[model samples]
Target: MFKKAFMSLALLLISALSWGQGNPVHFTVAQKQVSPSEVDVVFTGTINNGWHVYSTALPDGGPISASLNVEKAVGAKAEGPLRHSGKEINIDDPIFGMRVRYFEHHVQFVQRFKITGKTYSINGYLEYGTCNDEMCMPPQSVDFNYKGNGPKDAPAATDETAAATADDASPADSAAATPAGEAQDSVAAAAQAQPADTATASIGDQLWTPVIDKMKAYQPDTEGKSLWYIFLMGLLGGIIALFTPCVWPIIPMTVSFFLHRSGEKGKGVRDAIIYGISIIIIYMTLALVITALFGPQTLNEMSTNAPFNIFFFLLLVVFALSFFGMFELALPSSWGNKVDSKASATTGLLSIFLMAFTLSLVSFSCTAPVVGLLLVQAATSNNWVAPAIGMFGFALALALPFTLFAMFPSWMKKAPKSGSWMNTVKVVLGFVELAFSLKFFSVADLAYGWGLLDRETFLALWIAIFTLMGLYLLGILHFRSDGDNPKAQPVACIMLGLCSLAFAVYMVPGLWGAPCKAVSAFAPPMYTQDFNLNKTEEVKAKYTSYEEGMAAAKAQHKPVMLDFTGFGCVNCRKMEAAVWTDPEVQKRLNDDYVLISLYVDDKTPLAKPIEVKDSKGNTRKLRTVGDKWSWLEQTKFGYLAQPYYVTLDNNGMPLSGSFVYKEDIPGFLEFLDNGLKEYKKR
Candidate 1:
């Protein structure tokens, strides 16, 4: 049960840490001599499709803004702050809840420096932030270098703005026109074309060794998991829908309609089969139409878009109120009448299809909410076929009973009769929808930077909702729909009430900022909590620096647990709250392994940037503590996403498999155990 709970939470928070899996932006740097003693260092970034980088000129409390930092300069001094090519997008960002400026597709940053010597050189890096519609990447960096001889003749000073604004023109053209720029470009090309060993020698001793080959050998297979999970969730919803008052009564009527259509049992069974097929076709076709209308990318955008989330929140609240018996929600009576008349008039497969359509229309109130919630989830999956796949499962489960009853007519006697108990089911579902509606609203609130729904407030509301649901289930409370007298509470009802009460109790502590790991994915982040007292003793890492951690690991004769994480990573916090806090996991991490957590989103700048090459042989610069660790993770394990965990020996060789953004405690323990076992073997 605990495992299942954890898995569910993991699935809920999957989107938080699943993005930035690979490099979404590529960068190159070059130099152009604009004057005899001055040069323009141009940095160009080519962002991948559907991703963007924030601009350098943005206010605080927003996404990370791009900036240029010069780590080392010899015989030169920076003329001014960095400038960009000016093609930027300015918008009121939903995710950050602020007005932001960013660049998509391609952008360039240029810095001008004045040379004071016959030979001059400069070294620096560009720092930026990136995100797609679904999620954001950690802060990223790219390195730049230039070395050249100053022109012999001293030329008159040029207008700084005129030279800097060369962004309007081509800096490359100027670079090719000048001897110095041409020389520098040739040198850069030569450097890039140099042998790996020579380049390595130039960079000095490597701080961390690459383990890409070993890491690749143990990459996790995550493909198809989302679609399977979506299908199963849809199936669960379908099963729940079957118990609703809207759908349960239709089963027998549908079967009877088929039986009355023909005198022979075989003919009736064949017609019922066709009816079931029609239901599947109708639902799947709906999914296809939705996909065709919006496509996957737009659907993904809608999932996180603020206005759409707000709209969905209101829609769900209305659905929940309807389920609470405030008012009935029905399709137009005329539409159902039209379909019913069509079914009555026709005499073939078309008639059977119309009958299925009529049943769908009649059940709209109950099924629409469930279907809407399912499709919303599928949209967030970022998969084109997810909606269709989800609908297929829902349709299969909804259609299964009619086909089954037709095959075994006697089994119909065993089916439970619908009653006031169905109303109870609907009200309970109302409570659930009401609770979930807050999740959508919270997304919009966070995106718009609205402080209306903080962690404590969200928890308090959930606690109240569930407590009332428990009371309703236990017959201690009644809704307007419950009528005057309470029905006899069945064993399942009692069990569910107790469970609901238990869950409410569990969340009570969350009001004061408890982890309440069960709802970590649903609740607003802990950072949003106004008051928190549930702090645990954090499992401190022995060292934060890779070299120091490795030295300590070697001295202690223990494996190093390299934790590539980020402050902005939601699933990292989930794992820390739900998995690392486990007694067994804590003990294993503290005692059996030396932990080293590298936060890729840390903003503390380094004393000076350092040049390095990733495992993919791309040269870049590390300008901050975050940059250093982030580069190490990419260079060694070839993973940019977090919370990434991999165990390594003292020599920096991978000991076992890698782990990323999962809330499975036992699986994490197994990963630790495997690494430990492998270390012991050595």
Candidate 2:
């Protein structure tokens, strides 16, 4: 029903300096006149040293692929699919657990086109991502507008040119392409960028300190909060499902059957109690079924897996369609009939159990989508016990009414009459389900670097869905189940419909590039939007490395706020949108300190792997970019969690006590003020 933000103790941090390094790859778009009517559009990428740009042909789950998005092509049509040529090599990336192809130094992609007119302008954006040894810059865009003027000058039209073309036809051997010197140069550059006092040797000589804080002791605080949040989501979904026509109407009928069948007062109470218990057992069993087969570890992994995300997207879409009354998605009728037949033939307690099973089977069309949404969200929590807990919470809410109403026969008359409004609930949920499904789709799109569902596009779809749903609520639009020409809209319905309309209006500004902070976690980042009113930050000052940031802070006589964060961290994004964007908070952060953000999931490989032993006596091998930063966080601060924030002075002493997940603007301001006050005393 809702997504939970997850942060792992294993943190790998990123550098803020990478953002301003002038695009790891410089691009040029040129037109090669093949003939009077045919031309080749060649896109050339000159990659900076030590950086690798991914190929467009790479599969999903890898880094962002390089590609051209054609926005406008007047009087010109593309002849064939895009093709690439480069000094390509295959690297087995630990992050994706796959061998993917990438290019180094230089690459070119060509797309032939037929130009029908003399003055054709090809305008569009280029989407690509770049990563070096130290860190990867998130995918960035380049806008290109190319107009053909004259024929490209021939490249000396001779044998040497022919030889050059022949060489580029085949990929260079891997061993010859990457030299030891090239990797060392990048490392030395990082060293040079750091302040003079620090020894780069700590990373090399295994002198880096290891964190001895007990990981288990620290987990309950974060884990408990996360699990409680997920449980509440499940409870909320169950309560909402109760208002639907299919589930609501059957509640009284099922309770009445149990009360009538048992003959004595005590027996009726026992039968109803047993039936309610049976319902919980049935739903809990379903939630555990996946855990039983694959084990909890697999469920944890699937939460972040790319294919699983895409699968959830499609599955939710089907569920949304079913809820919209496109088709029923109940269990097989024969199966329900068999359970009912068994209940009829069986006596006493067994019959009561069978009746509960029958209820579940019959009501599945209405309950399954809601159940599926809750279970899917629980699975995404990546906690072993979350599914059982979520299902238990949902089933408890669902089963309570059945027992309570059976116990008190007179209360049945007080139940609200099932009306046309019940149908209204189902239709509204369909729109919501459809909107939530796009969020999963967006996660997959961003992970695979597919440009299909950008933030604006996501906002546009949501706007349309909410608008139509509002009209349906107002009786201006009708579904098959909604009665034609509804005479009087209830006050509740009118308010809900107006709220939906207001929500649609709220999203209109987002199309012109509003932050839409209320939904930032679900929407893509501001960088993904093509047009925007809010300006990008003018002062680019955050750093990813601890040493470099600290050194710079020391030189400038300021404090350093270490932001423990990640690419996949949901809460980090929330804090960035909700609190960090506040004027006072932003001003304080920008003016008071050198902000350094550490991303725990960055997978860029280290120049060379380091072997070190921590205080816990565990030998940790630091290999990837994430490993180095994660290792640093634990070693320096004796902590391994993020949105963990703390202020540090030049010589690496803590300026104030640590903070975690604090989003209140004034509270954060106080924390900053305290850190500054402590710094002055020092």
Candidate 3:
């Protein structure tokens, strides 16, 4: 009997251990009533030993950091992001080629709440993913609750044991002063940690909401029309066509074709007119189909969706490689061949239209990249009609040249031949496509909190790419079928060499932690660098929470530097890595101001209620910090674009004429200095 009991006990222990290893994430919420007006709520998470949780400061392209969502409650305002205190682990990520800081041990996230009613209860769920070293566990949401007394008696203020112990004073003094100090500290910390009050607001909160609302209000319902986006798409399409072999050679051929198609001398005008209309219809139909498939909501979702962005990056890279002559991308010949056969059999007007359609089909290899680029741009634009409109414009531009030249075939003599220059244009566009692919990768990296595409790494990649491109342009490199042009053309050669030299010069400072402001939005945060001057003080400085920063700003009567930046904002990264690194700029930022960076792309949700007026002017509670800041940015700034810098006084009034975008480092510093001076004068 004893032996059997021992074996059973051992088996039970083994089962228990296995169960613990597979345990789902568990969350607990502890509440301490500070006063009638405030309460401190602490969120603690317990994950299985092998599992890890991401920090709020997860770099771009990493993982979905933990977020807190508080259900709506009456008369209570939750104020701030979850503040984590625990063990930290650093790991080098391959994508960005940098170290990413994260939390491994059990983590505690603290948030404060201010009560406006007589009584209330805090209710919310902690949302996060558990990842072991090799793979990630699916994200889980665990519900938690904390009951609280109403404002009637003004709940007794309680000081943290640490703070109380540190006082080392008599019980009487500690009781009276410690409670007040703790309350004050809690409030101050809450204010500072609140994402809405921070200098840098998240992109979703700052730019997307307002722009989306504006687009919605203006269009109300974008069912069919291509709208403003179509124009942009068309412009890009036309520019892209200027480089393709099919389009370049056909420019002159089409003009002659139109002239021949037009029977009478003056009748050439009619043929040109019909051809242009056909092109518009074809591209517009394509755009319409895309809009119908992916509406505004999907577009918005895709912008921040990590997996989708990664796929897009890979797709573009493949397209770019194909363009660079790794392989040919061709449409099924059946479609174009059928159109070509019809073109030969049909007569007059029908034949002309069929021939135009056939030409478009045959040139799919050349136009596919442009189409893909436009579709991606339109999908992310938040403008439903942008794709359709852009395609229409592109098609119109392409057709217009053919029509106009046909009307006056004699002018064909002025058209440039499809020669070595055409191939050069293709190569240039291939490089462009390659560069843009990185942007998508950066987005995915930032969204996933992966540090694979940080600022320096991005710049290094660009430097290498541009260097290679310049070398190729200068005839130092050759590809398959590359003609033996031992002698380089003076103008082309000089321009290529000079551009290469300039690009190399531009990238040199980036290696030593210089801000390459020109391309900030495309790069990662400057803070990711191991040797960045901007990050040095940031690391050593007593990193105050957003709530603490706000309280200090309020007490000091200092203006707030509202920086609406993002992990994936190329311009924002560029501004920080390049412009912010300037000596004069660095000195001013460090000395004269309180800097707050609000990453619009940050996935971490706030622990409190984010109330803001929507485009309709109705007050709405924002569930995330990104939403609140996005509303603020749109309502306050006329523009919806980012790298938005706003200087606001203690009361949050925009310091008169204080706003900036990328590449305005000098202007931005001057603006901040001037605001400081004016505040002092006042």
Query: Each model's TM-score, in the order given?
Result: 0.74, 0.64, 0.59
Q: Which is the leading candidate under lDDT?
A: 1
How does candidate 3 fare on TM-score?
0.59
Candidate 2 residues 1-682, lDDT tens each?
1111110100100001112324568888777889866778788889765567777645443455665555566655555545889878775653344566778889888766556455455655555556643345444446666666323432221122222223332222112112123333444455466556653344633333332333223233545876797788878777777888778898888877766776776777778888889988987786666455544334433444456668677767877887777876766688889999999999977888898888877877777777767766776665766777787888887888888888887888998889877777888888888888887787667555566787799899989999988887787787666655665668887789889989999998998777665676677655456777765453223566666676678778998888876553434554675467656667878998888776554545678878878766967666555567777767766655456777776666666666666446566777788889989999
Quote model 2's TM-score.
0.64
Better of 2 and 3 by lDDT: 2
Number of clashing pairs per prediction, in order: 0, 6, 53
In model 1, where do residues sit more than 4 Å from their true spots?
1-22, 26-65, 69-80, 83-125, 131-210, 213-226, 292-308, 382-384, 447-449, 484-486, 538-540, 565-588, 598-631, 661-682
For each candidate, C-alpha RMSD in Å? 9.9, 15.0, 15.5
Clashes of 2: 6
Compose the digit string of candidate 1's lDDT tens values, residues 484-583.
8777889888899999999999999888866677787678766667787756565756455566566667778999999876544444655675568666
Tell me the lDDT of candidate 3. 0.59
lDDT for each of the candidates?
Answer: 0.73, 0.65, 0.59
Candidate 3, residue 261: Cα displacement in angstroms equals 3.5
Query: Candidate 3's error at 358, in angstroms?
Result: 1.4
